[model samples]
Target: MQAFSEILDQWKTQQPEDNRDDYYKIFTAVKDFDKHIARRYDGLRNSWFLGTVTALLAEKIITTSDLEDFSEEAKSKIARALKFREQYEL
Candidate 1:
């Protein structure tokens, strides 16, 4: 939902009477958004889940509260991953 709003914000900037440069900016924004989606949604096998959720949290696309229902073991792992992100600025 947030990402859709982001896409809409990008879309709103390019008016009907906009110049070519403005359209190119919009194109770049959409391309960047696509990259974000692919990074988040691609290769979502169970093997890839921890890394994916860690990334989702790191990017603020999902919050820690969103993961509250998971098992404590999973929560521990995610906490460590979040720490690693903070340490390395990833």
Candidate 2:
């Protein structure tokens, strides 16, 4: 995780002209990391993995409703993903 943060910081410093897009790209990378780890630990069918991600997103939204600078379409995708997560007994 610290290594990922360092990479993110390096990318942001190198591309200072577009911080928002870079931040979103970092968020996606982190999310993909979570998904990869989850699959390694619990396989692809685990709802707990999705629930954990949904919970993280919800927590972030509580702190900052920016949704990682997501556009309306991306926000809709997040909404649907979270909705799918909510159906499980996490």
Candidate 3:
């Protein structure tokens, strides 16, 4: 993703002199990111679509307007999921 790439790219300019520290930082960042990517993006099934969209909305990676193309029922489901997340998960 563009955001992920930008975050990785930033390491090039951060503490370049400390090779050991930089290696550890980059290693940890990439390992954490890899885990997230595996959990979120890998093996994406249709059943996960609505929940994933709701999460993306909560994370502000996507806008509410993006749901305009989906059916009203789907949009409603996502709205409810978001409401539940906001009220309970926070």
Candidate 4:
């Protein structure tokens, strides 16, 4: 499977602002669905769902900085993402 970062990278290049906005919306919806599924199912692990969310967030902020021009919004997102990177540790 293609990595989440690669998928987000492609979407970033498209620069579909409206779609990008909706992407977050749809992601949240799907995540909620997955959370429900996990709760309803016996074998589902919370980490599985959370890992996907974390991966998507990391992809948006780690794979590109095209939003850097926006304002502190972009900066904060980038900063939050970078925390996952080892370089930020020390």
Q: List CA RMSD, all candidates.
A: 3.9, 13.0, 3.5, 14.5
Return the clash pairs for model 2, or none. none
User: For every model shown, what is its TM-score relative to the native structure?
Assistant: 0.72, 0.35, 0.76, 0.28
**CA displacement after TM-score superposition, residue 69 of candidate 2 (Å):** 47
lDDT of 2 by residue, 25-89 (tens): 77888999898777656754554544544566764534226466756765676678776767763
lDDT of 1 at 67: 96
Q: Write the per-residue lDDT of candidate 4 for residues 1-90, one digit (tens) a residue.
A: 234455577677876757866577557667876786566465647645434433445556334444445467555654565576536542
- Sequence-dependent TM-score of model 1: 0.72
Q: List the residue pairs that clash in candidate 3.
A: none
Residue 74 local lDDT, model 4: 52
Give the TM-score comparing model 3 with the true structure, all chains together. 0.76
lDDT by residue (1-89, candidate 3, tens digit) is 66556655776667466588656766777888799979998999999989999999998999999988999999999999999999998
- Candidate 2 segments whose C-alpha is farther than 4 A from its true place: 43-90
> Number of the top candidate by lDDT?
3
**Considering only N, C-alpha and C atoms within 3 Å, which residue pairs clash in candidate 4?**
none
Give model 1 RMSD, 1 decimal: 3.9
- Against the reference, the lDDT scores of all candidates come to 0.81, 0.66, 0.84, 0.56
